[model samples]
Target chain A: MTSNDKIIEIEVLRYRPEQDEKPFLQSFKVPFTDDQSVLQGVQYIKDYLDGSLSFRWSCRMAICGSCGMMINGVPKLSCKTFLREYYPGKITLEALKHFPIEKDLIIDLSDFINKLESIKPYIIPAAPRTLEQGEYLQTPRQLDRIAQFSSCINCMLCYAACPQYGLKPDYLGPAAITLLHRYNEDNRDAAKAERMQLLNAHEGVWGCTLVGYCSDVCPKDVDPAAAINRNKLNSTMDYFLRFVAPRGGN
Target chain B: MSKRSNEPIVWSLFGAGGVVVAHTMPVLIFVTGIAVPLGLVSADVLAYERLAGLADGWFGKLFLLVIISLPLWQSAHRIFLSLHDFGITGGETFFRVVFYGAALWGTLLPLFLLVGM
Candidate 1:
């Protein structure tokens, strides 16, 4: 073997409902180079070792937002996490926290998906214009309001990082709420009133304790905590101002 | 289907209290606790008669009420949420009643004291 070949133990949490009743750890000795990522290590195991192993990944690049897993109990994208960092030692890979394990490394994202869909993630324009009316122009300042929030890639790493979401699954989570703020801040969007209705609930931004772990774990630097807090301020204003002008003022 | 939460009422108090405490509490602390005792400023600044005179005005009474009461609300809200964060959920209503109810009492008592002055 060449000196460049570095062998490391990769322990993956395996769960197959058909054969195994419970999830258990399975370790593989993976030989990798310094440039190989943790995802590549798992790919090596699948290609050369156990083909039955299951996981989800696409666009080996970090932008796909897939391949998020719990590495040493921290949420990270396997594509971005290098196995060389954990070389000469064993690394454990498990399904992302706060999510149900569908298979080995594949997690059930349906709950997060449902919550994302509930937030009306698409833009609802304040005033509709036909194609003949040309594009809606916006100043840089207008873009700046929502720009930071618009970077969320829906990786759900923030969800795994959020203790509030783990405790209260019904809570409208970080990414979805950040996306809501994105649309609300868009100058072309006029659905702030409708969006405010969703945000004015107990399960909305109020549910967030501002642990800020979500922001810390976000790969895209999307500060969902800030988005939620800002909306908290908005919801507070709406709550009190409802007494003054009950209807469309929001 | 959107549901409205009454958390805004308490949250507003918390926000206002946060602002009041952050902005003015340090100055109050330095002026009353440190400067007054150290004689860094004039003793007449907090003399009994001078304080009484300030309290006699409606605006001064209002200011005192806001300064004293809002911080209480803020602390109560923070404590209440912190309890929830710590996985203590059985006494939710009880804690709310005790914490916020105490703040309410604190607020009322100060108003009564300030107005009587």
Candidate 2:
């Protein structure tokens, strides 16, 4: 019950871009306290043992959405994984999966960023209006419909848990689809047709095999699976009703 | 996710066929059911008897084998997938060992039992 009992072995996956063709594991013995987080341990390692260690981190808390990595083969935020929870043990740390690794825990999020940009992330009104039209009003139920998905911080942990994304990087991924769901269900927004174009494409919604891991691994409870699946339903209706509905519906 | 999502009409057909085999095969196996949807869904999806039929001269037995194995494969894959999503995994190596072994039995068990040698 004191300051003396502090010893934990940590394994870190390493890659030196110039020297190594691929990545490998490196181990360190860190002195950890009961309250220490995995990110704290990583900080200790980088600060003391090796400045060469690479990983992404911004908010020491889970909010910045930047610090997602794999701990023991499952995607997690280093800021959140407590050392006490995994006590008297060896911890394995690796880069988030399903993304191209730039070095260590850092991955090229260009794919995910591009996906977000393509979905018309903002609201498109049903014909832009002036103050004379008044602000489009919405009921409580309408706000609740798209509210859950809007909590996404874009951490990309869902992509890390998803094997389909790893197997096919072209897949639109969970976060972007969740964003699309946000706008799709927003009563004030009228851009379903624009979002539908991206959702209905070959590399879009169809790529999901419904493995359902994305939702399971999601920290925000955004339920990207439900959003993506619902979008598919939306697209299917749009496809079949193309003749009957307004041609420029979006 | 969407109700309007593209339902793979072909897979749905396979699923229906497998469900039929799943229900009927147990009755056929014992040849005494009053009438129902009875056999094991997992066994039918695997199509283990398909291999048995390839080995045996009996056409009826062969047909049953093919029909039953489909349900077995479909069910097992779905089961493992559910396990994975639940995060109840023993890790990747553990999953590979368990699933690959199950797949082997999925293909070979019926043939070994039905065709002899």
Candidate 3:
């Protein structure tokens, strides 16, 4: 409302399944200050401009991994991206790529969720340790091995950035594979053989052509590309070792 | 149990070829294209008789074979995968045959030529 406050145009891709034949861009001019984020801008539109505008957001600080959208065609957390950066120009917002849009700026994450579940994200402990044995202890070195991959916040930015996943929807994409690697690297976990089955398949690590955009767009610095590449080596060894070793060297 | 991919067999070749290309290709290019052509290194270093002699030896034949063949495999794998990226998803088996078959021929032709030499 201040005299110096600037008004910026936000073109949002809107889809109302009941009414619209297809998604369309609807623009809104909003007044914003330098410190306000894209999320805040969208919120302002929802609160004042249009009540029915829909989007998912929480934490407003990029931790929840929601609020992901294509801002100028790049997958980004709207909460972390400040409006000031895209000031003086129009910003086009759309749902994340390679996902089915549920509504305006909201994507159906069931595919990603199913992929996450299929990876067996939790460690299947080597042996059932009794409470008397206490917590599963890990050395710093052991933790270090899986720590980077463990930082993934389940943000689908990597999936949006992955061309392979975009091309082949069944490709087991970045975040899920990275999470699978995290559990495989855990010293206390002995279910690598079980998990490696998923990775050994064509839909697994073999699907990745190492485009590496997944690592580049990762908000948490979880290099899913590196994780996938490392697993490729592991999978290759497993593939050949099966013929020589009784247990396939799992 | 998920069906395992045979990509590992081809990927192993690709990985090995990539390593060989990364480590030696630059040196090979510089030696032949730059150093010898520019006369920075002696032309005699790559003289025809000496070159043939090197190719005739077991170690040199192995080196030459690796230098020539591995890169073909590497390029074949990369081109094959790139076809997927280019949105050519159909006839994967045909494309695989075309790309990897050429690499196979490249490997065999050199082996036969080197042994005859």
Candidate 4:
């Protein structure tokens, strides 16, 4: 360690099912540089301080979305957050909120995964097109409609930020519904009517209270709140139009 | 498929009332509450006979009814949802009846008064 390297205290919330009855904060003082990220600091802890510490991370960059945690009570990608910002103050690292922690700083994502699968994330083609018929064509404007909603990395930060999901676990949370909207908005998709049924339910878009923190905490600026609200309009129209039109204006 | 929520009916009202409130409430408050009381404009601008004449017209009655009634619906919808946020999960039907019933009452009472006038 160089003389210029500053020491920062990182308190990680630890839970081992066989060993500990409950999760507890374990502090470690680590030497770090201004250039290093919070993820690197935790890496240093694992390398030298405690090998028993567990967390999930694939890419040191933010693209992988695996290193999300509660840093000072805010959901953030630890890889993108610099240690220099919290240099003088102690940093608390905990598993993402509104999820069951699997181990230290690692959350069980089964529920989120199940919700993801239920949304039918892939496009169900408007019509069957054979290889001889050629690929589906979309205009720039058509792609733009669904592009923003497609940026979600499945980091679950928005899920951590959502109070509604925290209250009602079954409420098809932010990222999943946002992805559902993404597919629905795509011009080549034919299953809008099929998908709209999920959104029409009380557990669907109606579950969102427009807390909007989901948009605020998003690393990619996905704006899940806007997607959900837009679908609310669609859902509302569907509710009334179903009585008049045969397909409910789908 | 899960049963659909009846929220869209009230949510449409909430959305409409939100627009009306956003567009008109500030102007209404400024004109009636602030400017008229402060005499920034002439007091006769809101004289009772003149106001009564405005209410007597069909268009004016419709306008008054919309301004008064829609906001009550908006507030009722908001308060109803806020009950969930505040963690009061029981007696959903009771709360819905009380809140929406009050907004309905607000709507009809104005219609009757404006027509009776």
Model 2, residue A14: C-alpha shift (Å): 1.2
The CAPRI category of model 4 is: medium
Error of 4 at A199 (Å): 0.3
Per-residue lDDT tens digits for candidate 3, residues A153-200, read 997999999889999999899999999999999999989999999999
Residue A238 shift from truth in candidate 1, angstroms: 1.3
* Residue-wise C-alpha lDDT for candidate 1, range A5-70, written one tens digit per residue: 989999999999789999999999988889999999899989889999998899898888989999
- Cα deviation of B77 in candidate 4 (Å)? 1.5
**A-chain TM-score, model 4:** 0.98
Q: Which segments of model 1 are wrong by more than 4 Å?
A: A87-89, A246-248, B28-54
The best candidate in terms of lDDT: 3
Please compute DockQ, using alpha carbons, for every candidate against the native two-chain complex. Answer: 0.68, 0.05, 0.77, 0.70
Per-residue accuracy of model 2 over B57-107 as CA lDDT, tens digit each: 667656555665666555554555456455554674676457645645755
Q: Residue-wise lDDT of candidate 4 within B1-117, one digit each (tens)?
A: 367978899999988899999999999889999998998998898889988888977999999999989999999999988888877879989999999999999999999999998
For candidate 3, the per-residue lDDT at A153 reads 91
Give the per-residue lDDT of model 4 (tens digit) for A1-250.
Answer: 8998899999999998779999999999999988899999899999999999999999888888999999999999999999999979999999999999899899999999998998899989967999999999999999999999988899999999998898999899899999999999999999999889899999999998887999999999899999999999999999999999999888
Q: Write the per-residue lDDT of candidate 1 for residues B19-105, one digit (tens) a residue.
A: 999999999999999998999999889888887777888999998899989999999999998887787868789999999999999
Task: Tell me the deviation in Å of residue A155 in model 1.
Answer: 0.7
The better-scoring model by DockQ among 1 and 2 is 1
lDDT of 3: 0.94
> Which 10 residues in a row give candidate 2 chain A its minimum summed lDDT?
A241-250
